[model samples]
Structures are given as structure tokens and as C-alpha cells.
Target: MSQWMTLFQKEVLEMWRNFKWIWVPLTFILLGVSEPLTSYYLPQIMKSVGGLPEGAIFEIPKPTAGAVLASGLSQYSTIGALVIVLGTMGIIAGERKSGVAAMILVKPVSYFSFITSKWAGSLLLVWISLFIGYISTWYYTGQLFDWVPIGEFFQSFVLYGLWLTVILTVTVFFSAALLSPGMAGFISLALALIISILSGALSNLLEWSPSQLTSYAGVLLTGGELPSDTMPAILIALLLIVILLWLSVFLFKKKELAA
Candidate 1:
């Protein structure tokens, strides 16, 4: 308990010292602004595009801030995913690279604390950034069109949260198990894409697979019907998160850390 607490504090302090501070929030903010801006202006943008042939009619969805925001949630979520994954790449990689772990290995700090602090810290950074993106999307979306479809909102965010949970666990596990941070991040992304492809290839087990986190979420977030059956999909995603997180911990514990 003491070790975990100490490591947590150290992790927090170190993160603060090294962090650029504004960038995390700014990433979400930029996405937030981009969402509504794109949604509201897309029609005009299309109209402005060069050389629409005479009598060629292009229909643009009338802008509603709420609809724009919901769309933003879907679009900006990709940015959140990038933020989470890349932040994870640096968590363990930095310690191994910077001699930070070498010095700590001499002290009483356990490998568990060292790795666990990183897991916790990286998760904190990802979740907080995701939340900021979510809120900004909502606020700007509301301001742009003022009317939101309540059902779409619920369905979208629930899927978003579940997807985030799965990605966070996958990234953390790979970051711990892989030989380097960049490899970990890229390998994890590849693993995710592979799962998606396999799920499509198999086609029958799509509902139980993690790919639903992306596809099913995209459907609801884009103002489509929310299937009542998605609950089971979310449950499977949650189970995967639990199992992978433990796998990460077990691998870290067994690794031959000098400390």
C-alpha cells in the first residue's frame, strides 16, 4: 500500500514536471473546434468546391449544433484514441531510456510500484484527455445547432466510453510487454487493426468481438438506431479489459527487473 501510494505521488509529480501542460487539453480543444467548424461549414465548403456542373444538385444536411456535436463525437474520438496510444508509448519507454529506472532500481522501490505507477499515470492522462474531448464536442455541438437527439447522445457516449476502456487496457499491456515504447504502441495499434480485420473475415462473431467498439459506436454516434443488443458486446469488451490488464501486470512482475 505504502509503495503504491509513494509511486503514485512520484508518478504524478514527475508527469507534471515533464509535461507540456497545455498540449493535452489543446489536442481535445482543437478537435472540439474542428468538429463543429466542419459540420457547420461542410455544405458551404462543398458549394465552394470548384466546378459543380450545371443541374448537378448536391444536398447537404442542414446544420444543427446538436447534430454537429454528435458527429464531432464520432470524428474527434479518433483524436482521443491517438492521444491515449501515443501517451502510453512514452510511459515505460522513457523510464527505460532516461536512466530514471536505473537510479530507482538502487532504491527500495519495487518493480511493481515502478511499473504500476506508469500504468496508472498513463491511464490518467488518456482518460482525462478523452473526457475533455467529449465535453468540448458536446459544448460546441450544442452551441452550433442547439438541438440534440437525446437517444443518439446516450448511445454514442456509452459506446465511446467502452471503446476507450478496451483501448486503454490493450495499450497498457503492450507497453509493458514489448521491448520498446514505440514498438509497444505500434504493435498494439496493429493488434487492434488485426482484430478488426479478423472479425470481418470471420463475420459471424462480430457482435462478441471488440471491433464492435468501433463499428457499433460509429453507428450510434452518427445518429443511427441504438441496438438494445449492444449490451452484450460492451460486456465482452469489459472482460477483455480485465483479462489484458492482469496479463500486463503478470508479465511486468515476472520480467527480470534489476530492482
Candidate 2:
């Protein structure tokens, strides 16, 4: 426990030194605020820059608040996820390359403690960034559009956060197991993309996929009936995260000790 705490502190300090603590949440916050702000004033923005010919009449319908929030979340699903993957792709790989992981392992520390500390640090960043972004989006969406029900808002937020957690866990696993950060990032992102595509393609057959979390989030935001299978999907995702974390620790220990 003490070793884990010390390693966790080192991870936190590393993040601060890298300015991840500043820029990551800021990126998310900007995404959240910009999405709704742009959506609310899109017509005006289009008129200003669209370069319409004389007296062109454009009839654009305003979207509901739910639609606006959903749009923002879609951005989160793509661009936001991409940014996070790229940022964290090197967490374990870079340390190994720099001999940091070897030095840490040479101490009286368990591989579980080292990996868990890294996971905790990464999760802290992910959660903080998402929370700031989501809250900002919710507030702006309520002001520009109608208010999303608080119950639904939090439900969707938590669900979407799980999707992100899954992404981070996969990244960590690859980072620890792979030699190249670029390859790790590519593989992790590819897997995530495949999962998302498969979830949509096989929705009827695969009711317990982690990708369903994003769909369930959209449903919550849009006031649709909550899918009955949501709990099963959540359980499956949590199990997958645990499995990945354990794999990362095991692989890191074996590979690092052999070095």
C-alpha cells in the first residue's frame, strides 16, 4: 500500500510536469463549451460566413436541447477519445524505454502496485477532464436549449464515462505489453474502433458490448426508453477492464524482469 501510494504520487507529479493536468481538462472543457455555443448560434454563424448571394432565404430549424447535447457527445466520442488515446499511449511504453520502469521494479515493489498506480493516475486525469467537459456542456446546453433532466443527465454522464474508462484500460494494457508506443496507440485505437463498429453492426446479437454504453448514453440524453440490457453491458465492460488491468500487470512484470 505504501509503495503504491509513493508510485501514485510520482505518476501524479509526472503528469503535472508534463502539463497534462492543465491542458487535458482544458481541452475537454473547451470541447464541451464550444459544442453547444456553436450549435446554438450556427445559423448566425453560417449567415456571417456562408457568403450567400443577394437576399437568399435560408430556413434552418433550431435543434432541441437534447439534440444539441447529443451532438456534443458525438464529438466527445470521436475527437475527444482520439485526443485521450494519443495523450496516454506512451504511459508505460515511454517509461520502459527510458529505464524508469526497470528502476522502479528494481525496488521492493510489486508489479501490481506499479501498474495500479499508473492506472489510478490515468483514471484521475480521464475522470477530471470528462467531468469538467460534461458539466460545461450541460450548463451551456441548458442555457441555449431546454434543460435535460438531471437524472438522465447524470446517468448518461456516468455511462459515457465508463466507455472512456474502457478506452484507457485498453491503452494501458497495450502500453505495458508492447515495445512501441505508436504501435500500442494504433492497436488500441483500432480495437476501440472495431468494437464501436461491431456494437452497431451486431447490436441484436451482442447486447452486452461496452460500445452499448455510448448508445445507452445517447438514449438517456434523448429521453428515450432506457435499454433493458444496459446493466448487462455495464457488467461486461467492468469485467473486461479488470481483465485488461491484470494482463497489463502480468505482462509488464514478466517482460521487465527478463530485461
TM-score top scorer: 2
TM-scores for candidates 1 onward, in order: 0.81, 0.96
Stretches of candidate 1 off by over 4 Å are 54-57, 63-67, 149-155, 198-204, 219-225, 257-259
List the lowest-lDDT window of 10 residues for candidate 2.
217-226
- Pairs with backbone N, CA or C atoms under 3 Å apart (clashes), candidate 2: none
Positional deviation of residue 210's Cα in model 2 after best superposition, in angstroms = 0.3
lDDT of 2 by residue, 67-179 (tens): 78877887778877887789889999988998888887887889999898999999999988998998899899999888888877788888888999999999999999998
Per-residue alpha-carbon lDDT of model 1 for 57-78, expressed as tens digits? 8888676554566566655446
Q: What is the Cα-based TM-score of model 1?
A: 0.81
